[model samples]
Target chain A: MELVEKYLYAIGKKLPRKQKRDIVEELRSLIIDNLEDRVKEGEPTDEDISQILIEMGSPAEVAKKYCTGTQWLIGPQLYDMYLMMCKIVLGALLLGYSVSIVVSLFSSLSGSGFGQIMWYIAKNLLSIIPGILAAIGAVTLIFAIIERTSKKPLDIDFAEGGKWNPSKLEPIPKKEEVVKPIESILGIVFTVFVLVLFYFYRDKIGFYYMSSLGDNWVMVKIFSQSALRTYLPLWTISWVLSLGMYIWLLCIGKYNMLARVFEMIVSALNIGILFFMANGPHLFEFDKLGADFIDLQPAVDFLTNNQSTIFYILAVLSIFGLLANLGKLIVGKVKGRI
Target chain B: MGNNQHTTDGLIQELRRGTLVLSVLSQLKRPQYGYSLVQCLAQKGLNIEQSTLYPLLRRLEKQELLKSDWELTGTRPRRYYQLNENGKEMLQELSDEWNRLAEVVKKLTQEEEIK
Candidate 1:
């Protein structure tokens, strides 16, 4: 009887909470009926109970028989998009972090030996793995929520009173008009990653040098407090707008003239910010570079002096991007493709 | 050979699954508890598992095809299920459909055998 109780308890644990008590009670009645038939003279043993339970099926298998519809966190409709999002995000994280660590290693090479720098890179890389895992978990949770809550997941609404009609489906776009999902996904990932980096790790973006004590590496941030304070808000706004635009493009799965105009405006604003920084103030500062970086002082001085040149180069590249986009827009308009 | 047997068993299960609702509906013409229903079906050479039949009975009840009550007069409480008016109508329609399907299947199989 205790074995029978234990078996029922196991099955009850897996049963849906709403129907748990009633189902368990019905099962108990059935089990008792089986026992009465089998154990005519004496009480049914654990072996008898075990045999019945085994015949009934495993607890999970039994419970699954009661569950209706999808029992998964993410359903079939959103699974492909969720998987694509994960791959894009994880790939970006790996590439971004790897590049950052390698850059840090090279910058601090004069402070530490090659082996020591490699060791630091490995440790830093290992530490970021949890962050990557959290990112994947966040993505899975969001898709799961959408799956649970949305009647038509991923905007794949059934046409005309929920009856899916194949003939009414939109024709596939031409190559030129097709908004590449990968492009939008990559753009979203890059913008988000960059925004996070600038927001959280702005202070860490600098020359890494071994301190005079030789006990630890120190970072001398490239941007002055004044510079970051001035640009941070502007950078956040533009990048956030880019993020929104990419998300919109991803959802709509196509590009339009308005999107092109929005992109151009964002690009123009970015270039404007770059040119302003280049001309307005001495953005790079080496005040934190101590005597430890004396040997690297000349190189740092050169970089600080030519920081404006770097900004000019960035602005020029952005201008070229803007022109290229403008050219495409004009061509599209002329061809009546927009 | 083992794979072929497994495939055949799967097909047989699928075939049986299509008839399961009809079988359960047919039995509900008389009030029967879960275990009594299982026994009744087994006696009729249709051995449905308890796990499958119990949930199905609940589902049918929810669908308003069957009505159930907890009969607590015995030593242990038993949930007795019987066909409601809706259930009786559904059973009649399903029985007619099943007979029609059976005739088609029989004709097809007989023709195959002759060929």
Candidate 2:
């Protein structure tokens, strides 16, 4: 009985005080009833009682059955709130640190001395503060939305004898049920159109500006004069092919796989283009290229001369596009059948 | 139209069933043990079963919306249930919404009767 009490207490401690006594009392009675029954059957030894208790199962198991409907975590409920708050605070801090670093780097590079660096850091911190607050606000807003939408009770049951069954929970809204195929088709078409527009307008938008300023822009003149003129047509062609593939995939209702493949291909090609644009000039001097290839000089020279900067920009843009596309793909996947 | 009436009744029952938890939560603002709570609600015509009430109390306690503690009343220790802070806030909001809904429903039904 003492052993049973100890076991019951251990389990009861995990439950709310309101349930603890009832569950403990009920469990005690059960063990006593079991023991008495066993004794009546002529097994009166202490060893027999111990064996019977063991057969009844571990103290944890017995307590679990009695407190089957209770929930227990490592600590109080407020601890969860604290953890959530900490995550938000830490995320904000990291974003602030990165922004500060970028601002400082730019300020120093532009010949803004120590004072300017400090000012930039302060300005960056101030700018990021609202963003952090907005992120936190967004999280809260999402929580409110979920709370408002959720029709079920707050309890989550995961116990041996608990009546809680996850299967009984409402089914998640299916992706296909929510998003129609037409919407996805439109999205794919829109992205392709944007890519095509950019490709066609490459030269007019001063694609060669980064390599050759032509006495128009200081930043443009400083950078390599690699005219992306040659790659423009190829890029446009690739975009059209990728767009066609996307449309075909969407029509067949295989948007996810198609988007992933397309993103990977585009990212690879963009990275390659950026690399060539940055390194082509350094790899082959203008004297070697002769006057006939002067037009191509800007593209090659820009790539070779400003390889790091070009790579950084392309990598960033590619990664950003990849992430955006990946997000859409995942949303589409989760919204299954749509 | 006859089938529609039946469907509407069913929908009303379904809606009430969904709000049963909220109703339970509202009643548990003051400390009331399990049997007492069941009796109190039954007297008020909520008509909740013991099996349902017990499980719901457990669930509410688990959610931290309700707090429970055992008191040695008589020979048997009885578990007393009370609404927690979050439960109080939730009950207030739900009550306001419920009242507003009831008013709207009453006005709509009255308008229908006139028609």
Candidate 3:
């Protein structure tokens, strides 16, 4: 009798809450009926109860049979997308972290000792674990909510019965029309890495070297504080917008009119920022390197002399890139590929 | 040899899974408590475990194919299940489909044996 109660309790605890009591009671009655038929003469012994429970299988197994609805946080319909998103996020984080670590090491090499460099590398590597974990959690949480809230077959349109149209199913996109996830993932990683570099290590963007074997290492920051401060906001905005657009394209998984328009706007912003910076200020701080650095002074002087010309070249390159992107968009539109 | 026996058991289980629902539904035309239904099916040489049958009964009731009530006035309380209108219609349709499927399978297998 005690064993039966224990078995019933084990099964009951695992059953879905709404139907738990009824299921438990029904199972109890079934067990009792089986007992009455078998142990006709007297109170059922432990042996009889054990046999009945054993035949019914384990408590967890029985409970699972009665669990009617979905028991997954992310159901099958969304599971593939969830897995892909996880892979993308993890890949992006790893690439971005490695790039940042290498850039940081290069920027700091002139000033820091070998031991310090090793410590920095260790710290950067350790930091990646938490970032990876948090990103995974965020992706999982988003998919879980979608699984619970959305209709089954998660990609189903919201349009009611007759509102849908066969014409709305666009033709199979050409290779170029499809937004390759890897491209967007790379774009996302690059934008995030650049943004982090400029925001946190703005002064470290420079030249670093030792003039001679016994000489102390020296570094000269390329950009003046005022110049960097002036451009930081624009850089931040452009990169943030690019990051958002890349993520959106990744989710949509195709190139279309809306994406084309957004890409053009971001390109225009880049052109404007580069052109303005090209004409704006004495962009590099040449005095910081000075004439005293024996081996590197000539190189520093040459860079100082040609800083404006360099900026102008960069601006022209950017303009060309923007034109190329615009031309592709036009071609895609004419071909009905967008 | 053990692996072969295991494979055979799995295939047999897969074959039985669909028909188990039809078997339970066929027996539910008359009201029967969980134990009695189990016993009746067992007597007919259709052995279903108590755990399987009880949950299946609840599921059928949930689907509105069967209706049930607790008979507390009996010596001991027991929930009795019988087919509702929907269940009768379902059973008829399923029976027709099963007969056709059985005929097709029988013909194909017989032809294979002849060859």
Best by TM-score: 1
Number of clashing residue pairs in every model?
0, 24, 0
Which runs in model 2 stand beyond 4 Å of their true positions? A1-338, B4-9
lDDT value, residue B15 of candidate 3: 97
The per-model lDDT (C-alpha) reads 0.84, 0.59, 0.83
Writing each residue's lDDT as its tens digit, candidate 1 over B1-115 gives 3568888999999999999999999998989999899999999999999989988999899899999999885676799999999999999999999999999999999999998
> What is the per-candidate TM-score for chain B?
0.94, 0.84, 0.94
Off by over 4 Å in 3: A41-47, A94-130, A148-170, A177-180, A199-220, A223-229, A248-258, A279-309, A332-338, B1-8, B73-75
Global lDDT of model 3: 0.83
Report iRMS (Å) of candidate 2.
Answer: 8.5
Per-residue C-alpha lDDT of model 1 across residues A285-330, encoded as one tens digit per residue: 8765688567877988998899999999999999999999999889
Candidate whose DockQ is highest: 1
Chain A only: give the TM-score of model 1: 0.73
Question: How high is each candidate's TM-score?
Answer: 0.80, 0.31, 0.79
How far out, in Å, is residue A99 in model 2? Answer: 61
Residue-level lDDT of model 2, residues A1-338, one tens digit each, is: 56666666776776557767766664465455456645777645777667756755565654444455325331243345434543534443554356435533543334456787678767867866765677566655655554556445433333336466667654553464343445554555455444533443222232222124222211112222254545555566666666655544543344346456675777777767666655444322233343444677778677656666866687778777877877877787787676
lDDT of model 3 at residue A59? 97
The Cα error of candidate 1 at residue A105, in Å, is 5.4
Model 3 clashing residue pairs (backbone): none
